[model samples]
Target: MPGRRARRRPVGDALAGTGRFTCGVPEAVGVKRPSLDAVRGFDRAVYVVAVGQLINVFGSGLVYPFATVHFHLQVGIALAVVGLGLGARSVTTAAGTAVGGYLADSVGRKPVMVSSMALSAVALASFAFVPALAAAVPPGVAAAAGVSRVGVAFVGVCVASGFVAGLYTPASSAMTADLTDAEARDRGYALLKFTNNVGFGAGFVAGGVLYSLASVSVFLLDGATSAVVAVVLLLYVPRSDVGGDEEADADVDSSAESGASLARWWAAATQPRVLALAAINLGIAVMYAQMQTTVPIVAKEGLGLTAAQLGTLYVLNPLTIVLLQIPLVDAVAVWRRTRGLALSAAFWAVSMVVAWAADVGVGPVAVGVALVGGHLVFRTVGEILHSPLASSLMSSLGTDAERGTQLSVLEMAKRVGIGLGSFFGGLFFDYGLSTAWWGVLVVVCLGVAAALLLFERSVTPRENGAFGDATES
Candidate 1:
């Protein structure tokens, strides 16, 4: 035993070492806790990718908040048509995420990321010309184009941009996972989240001002940012960050020998732990989706808040996340990820209950706005706790060979959940069940919290091996 070299623990084993199956304890004496300093020691590529993502998401924020307004009001496209375009984009984006994951594992992360960004730049730039293109067509021809040429062109742009955006997600995530070791991965993701929120919050404020002066210029600016990010990622991020090539290729070859690409995807997708994680994440995603889809509507229509007040509410989420994400990451680092996720769900459940009270008029209009603000703050806590831990957990679930696919599955689940939440949130409002909707989500969040605890109990033994039997030192 004296002469033998010690084997390194697997990522799952390292994760399990915090405690034995139940909620995790703090790290043992002398174990280095995760911190901002640890993040500084991460690979150069991690910072590169984070910078690129910040740039890209800022560009997205410039367009995302205004896309419906531009199309439905300024461009004279029907609201229904604009909604259809967004729905189509969601569908295409989901499909692209699956395709992107496969390509990330197969070709490489860098190529997929760069190409997706380039395509997204082109698609976004093309939005500036849609009004002109629609104008060029005669009235008859526009009618024949289905809800006017603007609708057609807008949908086309949405689909193209959404798919490319989707493609970027898994590739970028996998690249980050490749760059950081398991210990540093959580902070690495938190850093990325911080940058993304800062960029997006800034862009949202800027876009609000610029959209009034020269709306077309906003689209062009967004496109320019995407192009800048594309160039940065291309020139800076090393090709080696593509990652898992030899192992991925061997996996492809093995799958090829046994079955088709679909089969290969199915095999990866069907892993019990991956599915379990995805299912849990779906509930979380649905809870989050309500903020984007339902909260503003309730604040405006139900509580009589002005446009500016609603905007402030919308802004609060990213602001909170940008300020607190890193410190929170350090605070939670010693706990088992599942415990963090469960706490996140509890926070979400409380937020939903608060939201219900606000909708039902807990007091004066001022009180309603205050309640809504509290809702956003609580929801932001859940988001901060969930995002990095979920990403880290998903990353740990797969071997090098199928990590991309594994992350992709998680992305797909989020996409589906968001779509479902938006649909159901709207449906309930339309059916005069707005107050009931919050109650329903409260139950969902609590159920998810309980489920996460159970999931942790079941999976700990398999993940940690002998470590599962031992408490934290």
Candidate 2:
């Protein structure tokens, strides 16, 4: 076959905490050579995928903001029930993502993706019944225990969502690779983040509405919408992009001669770069997760932000990405990739330092303004620095056949970090803000160190700008 069809010059970058090449947009649209098309070419495909992700993430965001309120206020769950539900869901989600990554790598992206969404639908649907169960709580039940029952249900949904994540994430990442070359990976992933951000915003607003009216029904509504998304994806998302069914031929290190062991699964998930990717992602998760707890605490108690002002924080982060990530990616593409990574680390360090200072004792207004503004600049800068390079790196490193699996692993690591960080950070923030801020310091500092590891001339920039140095797809 003639060397892959002569392609167009890649579009220079910017995206949601990511960026990518924009070559095919003009040609695909019957336009002539490069004229700085605005998210036109391959960007179109990136946005399409965003639509699906938007739906999925919106559902997630909707549930997150209100689950507690639903269980306690409307359903009358005890405090212990709330804790159990949160903890159980976190663990279950982590487990699901890990297993799901293996499934994506070993089985096929489509199967996992399809399965995950269906499971999420089932799990989310089940949550609708929580109100009914809570209504039956005995008068003398441990308030916390009644809450625990609610927690158990949440845990159940989380476990099922694990299956959803296992199925959806791998396929989703692989699809990023499928639709574009290495050059476009950053933009593709950035688009993914943008979709998520927008979804989250929409969800937050919708959730406030749902919960103020009736919390449990939000789950029911979210579940129904997600089921619709799954069907559409099943109908449209290409299976080959996720992976082919080749696991039957792969070796299975059956352990303890046990029926339910994960020996084979672990073997697959531990593939090279998976752990390194996870470590870096773990740091990101820690930083990212604080939005719900730690970051907001710093925002409110430290900075004196009202709910409306707090909402502005979200606007700054995503809006910047929407406007700047692609251009930033294009610019970084000209410099050393590691330099971008380093810059990203610095941005994180600054953002945290700013927030920490405010939280610890900086004047409330000054800290608040600095924290929000600093966060906007730093996060935007960080996204430009890390998004394209990291994603492209993963694209470069993973085997063509297993690219989706690699993406799944990266996502899995993030979930793991989020779970652990949420609990730890929550306790610190709730029990003591100063101590919690310390934890943030340690994590952000480590993020800087992780960036240094990416140095060393051995690392080469791929045709695509992403995280790992995987072979081009």
Residue 53, candidate 2: alpha-carbon lDDT: 74
Q: How does candidate 2 score on lDDT? A: 0.58
- The digit string of per-residue lDDT tens for model 1 on 337-408 reads 888889999999999999998888879998999989899889989999898888888887778657788888
- At residue 245, give the lDDT of candidate 1: 48
Candidate 1 lDDT trough over 10 residues, lowest sum: 1-10
Cand. 1 TM to true fold: 0.81
| Among all candidates shown, the one with the greatest TM-score | 1
Per-structure clash totals for the candidates = 0, 44
Residue-level error in angstroms, candidate 1, position 86: 3.6
lDDT of 1 at 144: 78
lDDT of each: 0.75, 0.58
| Candidate 2 structure quality by residue, lDDT tens digits, 105-131 | 556666676677777777777788764
Please give each candidate's TM-score: 0.81, 0.74
